[model samples]
Target chain A: MDKGIDRRDFLKLIGIGGALIVMDTGRLAGAADNKMAQDTLSFIQLSDTHWGFNDPKINPDFAGTLRKAIAQINSMKSQPDFIIFSGDVTHTTDDPKERRRRMGEAREIIGGLRLKNVKMMPGEHDAGLDNGEAFQEYFGTTHYTFQQKDVNFIVVDNASDSTSSIGDTQLQWLSAEMEKLDKDSRIVVFTHRPLFELYPQWDWWTRDGAKAIDILMPYKNVVVFYGHIHQEHHHMTGHIAHHAARGMLFPLPAPGSVPKRVQIPWDNDQPYKGVGYRSAVPKKDAYGYDLTEFPIIKV
Target chain B: MTNIKYLLRIMVVISAVVLAFAWVHIARLAAETQTVQNPVANQGHEQVIKITVKRFDYTPNKIRLKKGVAVTLVFTSLDRTHGFNCPGLGVRTDIVPGKSNTLRIVPQKAGRYEFSCDVFCGDGHEDMSGEIIVED
Candidate 1:
């Protein structure tokens, strides 16, 4: 409860606490409100690592950036309960062999983290063309829901499909899943692309996301965390909070902010300027979680 | 067994009546012969088509052309890096933003061919594609 302990320090502090709590990722999303403790529960969300991507102008040190992120997470005084990689774990490659190689390298890099409980979703780059074949082969299911304490974490696969949609089957699955949760439950949804339309012109919006939004409208507290756009963005639809995290590889200009959707030029002096990760802790009683972004800065 | 046989006979009769009606209509239509014109003839011999590649879609999703005529595609992207690849036609070009890439062809045959974006622009990259229709 030290006010001086920022999120980064807080994560380092959490690791020292006793007992490795293994909560069900399922109950983590739908059924664990009663288990909510007075203390806040926190976790890290990292996205768009773009492993194996070789763009010197945008991010020449892409591999080093990831390694640095893992180092930061590992050096924490206390470790988060789990870490969630929102999507785009690997950059796109038409060669299936290269794609698998990138996935393996990404897995090996992320394996360095002290936290063992890791959850992942897909970025369109990972699953879009292959319909999640390569991603599923490496990361398992594209969509699922889990629970931790009083919070519900729903991870849907909107990236693997070219339409950038949570397919009809996953949409129906979401609706049916919401039926089982209380209207007052705190729900956190994670996907690779924004669940609500951020900017359709840049392919930022999911085609049928409104259907998923409609299903969650009844819920009192709902927040979405996604990562396709490659920058930090916050938008609200009704009571739902939608947040896009900063990608680990590079940043893209805001919607229509530029003439085209190009990577923000890397600051020569500042290498990993706008790229980083985020952490959130639950609020009292199931209202919502407080969020903080930690950018990777040079020492 | 008898009831099943009767039902089959009724179905066969109904099909026969439907076929007879279709035959009469065809016979009457055949008697009313009309001249059909080739629309491609009016479209000129050489054609220029511009395609703007956005995130996951091509502005001109379908391009119409006359067989054995020159067609030029002036391709540019409104967004990130995209590629145009038509394997059947052996045509591939990179569509970069702020620049135009042209692919020219004179299709020798009348048929439909597809072109796709092979570059990884974003999550919707796979969905970016268009078609070419050559009319005889």
Candidate 2:
């Protein structure tokens, strides 16, 4: 519960120097490429909507909550440039047809957004049942890379393997990408589960996360944002700052802090407690992201 | 008929603007990560810093240094005794009042190594910590 370490302040101290730039191999060189290199873009990360989930005791308004969260982002005066759903977009289903149906329904629900660029990866709930066959059909590519504001954004699919390993294939893809960046270049990684072993018993730890960390260990400014834990948490694996986003569905107990990994019964008093989403604004004064948590809209 | 043609022309213009706006976003997202032609050199000159440790916290809790630079952190405890343990970076040391203690490190890589007091000094021992940032 006590994050103890002070990463927010430490990251603020990381100087941006100048806008770090990387041109597309051949086409669109020069200042034309720098258009997106500006650090003013902001994005929101909404995780674990768990569409098709039906548990009134834990979340009576599960369906309503999911829509309202999207509406809340839609209503923002300054709409985010992008949205990254960390994982578990739908409730886990054993039936193959049902899984695709849930994915379709959930995609339609999230499609209500006014903006596009809604990037999503899979979670064990969506992928583990079939090694991501259902999810990839709807979302395409379990893992990939993109860039914004001179900062490289990588989405690593740890959920696809079911065992929660980055897998040798994806890890090699990650290493190849890592090799391309300058040591001082800024990088932000997104994963469904925590990259470091937070609580293996509770499935918080990635099977081969340490190896991924070793690959990313050399970078000067690399931050990993993930979801799986239903509650907000922050931890430090050396220099890399790992922050977990709360689920859009229901909240779970802290790692082994409780007897079981059960969801806390929905509270009428604090319906949105231990649950919400995160928005990150690239700090203009410095080099890293300034992250803030936002609650789901009640209406 | 001329009015109808004009309306069609206006619609085409609006669509083009919309299409162009979308392309910028697509292109940005499409941009690939490339290997650095010449990565920054890791090694730098040596440096030194003075730090103070106390109950529940560390003074100047954040320190920044260049990667591959050898540096010594001269530490002194204001109260009893505390420890600076950074397992990630493999750097640890004890801070004792009226005693000489220091951590000499040459960070081969750039990272945010969070060091905390390993020895339990008091109830506030957990909060007694600081960060060492090695940059390229």
Candidate 3:
């Protein structure tokens, strides 16, 4: 695998978006790195585009950045089976008209991609204020499950409630869903916020995520990918692997790294610093997923 | 011998009664203090209370004040950054590192208010919480 050999000059040689990274997640904590699944499907995970956010210092070219990423993925030789946008498709706004406008613009931009199978969930910014009203108009459902290549893909809606809770009723729904799956079934969970308390004070945690984790614990093979931290973070809750994606907009600092949880200063020298997306391809046995972090398309 | 034993028993009973009276008196004084907050402050004077916060706790974990009284809550961080968030009182302020952050709050009602450092301190950040008791 090209990822096996960490060529220092490889990234520079290929330029920004020509990244082909294949990380065998076996080395990641709680990731078994079991024999790769043969019949498993591959998909792209990107998050937090914040479509309507306007900050010149943070990202003056917000629309351009989103367009470029979509264009680059479309140009890929081999397309992913599907793509999942974890959350925050649009930035939060108090104005109802402006909120719908942003979602409409986001829908237009994302439609440029070559693939048709796209799954999206709302983030606190997109749905917290009106409880997924605008997002539902653009996208179909807040939370639902789909199966692809024998993998049960569960989308949990934790951002619909502004209070950062999955709620008890949704928890029961998740519990009932888990009862139908086999202990050895391959599961991939997509949500907006980290299911565990990565950092509660910064709103980086779900209020009742612990209960959701408790439900998923019975399964031997499970992984979670979420976006809200605005930077890539990998964590382990029991044997489950939870990975946070780098936001499509500007990136925020590490959890509690500074007095304020603000965006890292943008440098004209490194405009695309700390922004990227990931691709997860299953190995032969499909017991685990290997992630590839691709840099933002040069705009 | 019987008179001596009776006298000893009477002495024990007297000691128990005296201790019980003292306990009741102390309890009443504490209750009065809680209701009164700090009676030393004269009218129209703003109560100034300085508090410091560290890793996972506030030094003065509880603050007592009287209703309709304005208080200047002076806050400082002994180590890194922290916050004082009393949603019940509609007051929020950050505790700057090596600096003093202050907020003035006037309690309109008598009740218990909860506050915590909103900044992500560490694993035990949730523990860095306290209460504000406003008395009528």
Candidate 4:
């Protein structure tokens, strides 16, 4: 690997190459049929499942709802190349046994989908007890970089520290990793906490996320996705776009909009009105990402 | 004879100290086990209310009761973290997932008190709110 070519930049190069193939074809059907030839890679991002949570005040069938979401993903005509669970897999406590149990249950449910690969990050809830030691034990490395084709996927663990510090080691690793990739490569950063300040009072912002963003600023094609706020929010700063996914567990109020944060109560008469789903795709410029969100409703 | 009396007095003192220590220990245990008595014990009668915290909503969202009545609320979280907070009543407790959290509240004033989940459970978390109305 070249010193300036990071995994993300490399992945972006692959994405660009893939997009170029599609652009050359200039036909949707042809692009779809020749996806592999086009080098188009797709991945699913699911966030804030909050498994093992049973709250009648919210929904009695939270787990079932999550299963349905998984089913929806599995049933998609074009299966994602991989699945990324943004974070908050569990409600509270950092107990290893409980964490393991929840992870097992999630795996079992997702396993039925028979997906090829599932990658995960931890949310604050998942990292409540021991700085995500239990979560890391159940899942693999919290933060890592992977390259598929020409796109670089950087999975960082913001939940590992209370102040949301990427830590010196991870920062050094990221810097060195970025040094290996070309600046034009497309990069995707995934974490449980939003890299920018979403809402500080509710502990929504990562304290040291600016440090991570500072490092990523030099990259031309960078996109970040996170799940902790439990709602769909999108923003852009310079070349990077930030997106937050809707939580599968329940719906929360927007920051500072409510007098205080509370679990949105369930209305039996109006079931399935609160949940939402977010989808993203590479923008036309190939330097940004566009998002579309739909609220999940019972038919 | 005088020396014998002195020995007897020492044994008596030792026995008295042991008895006092045992008495204090037993008293402490009793106090630890005893439930804190309601200050308004004779102020009103007891009432039972069931509050369910589930995904999206709460059943019987509006809880109505008589003022000064002792309320025993049985709360349970249906899906995730739900908080039962009545700032007026100064009551706050987190209803954990899969477990029931019981609370005893004796409203001191004759007014409408509001309650909501403080934890950010999901998307509609802010809208997931309710109230407690106390009548005369």
lDDT of each: 0.75, 0.75, 0.78, 0.68
True-contact fraction per candidate equals: 0.03, 0.00, 0.00, 0.07
Interface RMSD, one decimal, each candidate: 8.1, 16.3, 9.8, 7.8
Task: Single out the weakest 10-residue window by summed lDDT for candidate 4 chain A.
Answer: A1-10
Output the better candidate (1/2) by TM-score: 1
Runs in model 2 deviating more than 4 A are A1-39, A285-287, B1-136
Tens digits of per-residue lDDT for model 2, A1-299: 21211223222222232223111211122121232234467778899998988889989898788888776566444456789999999887668898899999999988998768899998888887588899989988889999876778999999877556789988999999999999988889999999997865445777789999999999978889899888888888888888899999899888767534568898886666677787776666564666677665354
lDDT of 3 by residue, A1-299 (tens): 11221223223333554223312221221121111223457788889998987888898787688887786566454566789999989987768899999999999888877888999999988887788899999997999999988789999999887667799999999999989999989899998999997865556778789999999999999999999888988998878999899998788888768644667767787677788787787655556677776666453
Residue B54 lDDT in candidate 1: 83
Q: Score the docking of each candidate (DockQ).
A: 0.03, 0.01, 0.03, 0.06
Q: Which residue ranges in model 4 land beyond 4 Å of their true spot?
A: A1-39, A294-299, B1-136
How well is each residue in B1-136 modelled by candidate 3, as lDDT tens digits?
9999999999999999999999999999997895466433333566877677897788677889899988888887888766777767887777888776989889999998777765545445545778889999
Give candidate 1's chain B TM-score.
Answer: 0.65
In model 3, which regions exceed 4 Å deviation?
Answer: A1-39, B1-136
Error of 4 at A279 (Å): 3.4
Best candidate (score: DockQ): 4
Interface RMS for model 2: 16.3
